[model samples]
Target: MDRVLLSIGHGYSARALARLLKPQGWRIIGTTRSAEKAGTLAAEGVEPLIWPGTEIGPALAQATHLLTSVSPDPEGDPVLRQAGTAIAAAAPRLSWAGYLSTTGVYGDHRGGWVDETTPLTPSTERGRRRVAAEEAWAAVPGLPLHVFRLAGIYGPGRSAFDRLRAGTARRIVKEGQVFSRIHVEDIAQVLAAAMARPDPGGVYNLADDDPAPPQDVIACAAELLGVPVPPEIPFETAELSPMAASFYSESKRVRNDRIKEALGVRLLYPDYRAGLAAILAAERAG
Candidate 1:
């Protein structure tokens, strides 16, 4: 059987997964919201369709696997709301399916550890919507769904390096404010492993072993670049947008035991230090 993947809301994380799958002879149909992005996707060998304006049924019929990276809004999940019926009709033929969710669902842990079994008690409105979307996905009968709740996502182009270079980096120190994160490469690997070993309804938390304060990561990146570290600013005094402030409202360390034990997955960057170094190295090597 041909290996075809229908990736809805194909964004950063989905692109990483595509890098792995495309090299392994998989055909990917990704959805974007713009014509320019569709052209870019096509350049990367992805078949892109403008979503919300396009019929997803034909793509669903072609897919042996499915993944949705779309976040929910005030209403609900876009994929479920728009193409829920097509997905259900195509469910039985799908070999595997996955959902990209945020660790924010287990909100306000006060820097405590949370596992897969942690009860969903989101603090933010965005987190609450994810909980709703997860429930909605679960309601779809016969869908081979696996939910991966990701932590603060950082990578080559989207890390502290960008902020430091842009002169907008700040070491915002909030006491006991620690966050778990995963390298984009590690996330891609874990997703690949899950597809290889499909276990429907499996929930995994994807994060690095290190759960350090935001200041520490900024310091590490600055040191790596041989530049002066950004000045530390207390969270209370930091002038932040509401969106940025919302991120500081929760603190937690997410456990990645299930991915290791169940899928035999090994992370490339187990800590922020290692992940930062790798990103910096990739830039220099390029």
Candidate 2:
């Protein structure tokens, strides 16, 4: 049996990946910070284990593949900080290892396009941390580490529809600003494809074909729900949370050609339109 260990699997993208691989005869063991999340993973047919609780002895030795979706904190990459040596020691048994990163590592491109080879010039603290984390993982000796730089991820309960219904959706318009996004399903599919074709120390950008403005996506969701689209708020005057405002600082259209060419990935939802429509359709069916 193919055994994979997902560090920080309770997150949105990792959970989706677990579902995608479970049916393929893969035994998945996911780590979480809490027993609450462990129970959730268990209910979804995944073996959940608490991370940083015990030495990752059995899991690390048994895993053929390992993936870490945990983000870097001020202290640095959490997983690497905790188990870097153990992970390196177990590299002989591990066929592939993956680290989930963000496109923010490219920093503010002033609405230009960026690819995998783009220089890391992050403008935000979070982006800087991600860059540092990516480097740390790459330096792990003998670990077949592949880095996936993900764009804005949205799916199911996390889409604009939920925000609109919750009365928290905003049409914050920053002039000449567009952002690349990826459906969660696409991220899961791409990871699966990468697992099939392991590439050590390869970096791939996971983004959709369409890079749209924030306001336009909100308008589209409103149209789907027959709700009034919120009035456009100028980005300069909009009262955005620190985290939300930080997103506006960067504007880059991320290219996903590598995923397509290398992984042979045909996206299930190529753009926001297709992605949002699928979310709405699923809601209606439920």
> Over 4 Å off in model 2, which ranges?
none
Question: Clashing residue pairs, candidate 1?
Answer: none
lDDT score, residue 236, model 2?
88
Evaluated against the true structure, the overall lDDT of model 1 is 0.94
- Residue 175 of model 2: what lDDT? 96
lDDT values, one for every candidate = 0.94, 0.91
**Residue 7 in candidate 2, Cα distance off native in Å:** 3.5
Which residue segments of model 1 deviate by more than 4 Å?
Answer: none
lDDT of 2 by residue, 1-286 (tens): 5566655545899889988988988888888888898899899998888887966777888899999999899999988788888888888788899999999999999999999999999999999999999999988889999999999999999999999999999899999999999999999999999999999988999999999998999999999999999999999899888999999999999999999999999999999999999999998999
TM-scores for all predictions: 0.98, 0.98
The TM-score between candidate 2 and the true structure equals 0.98
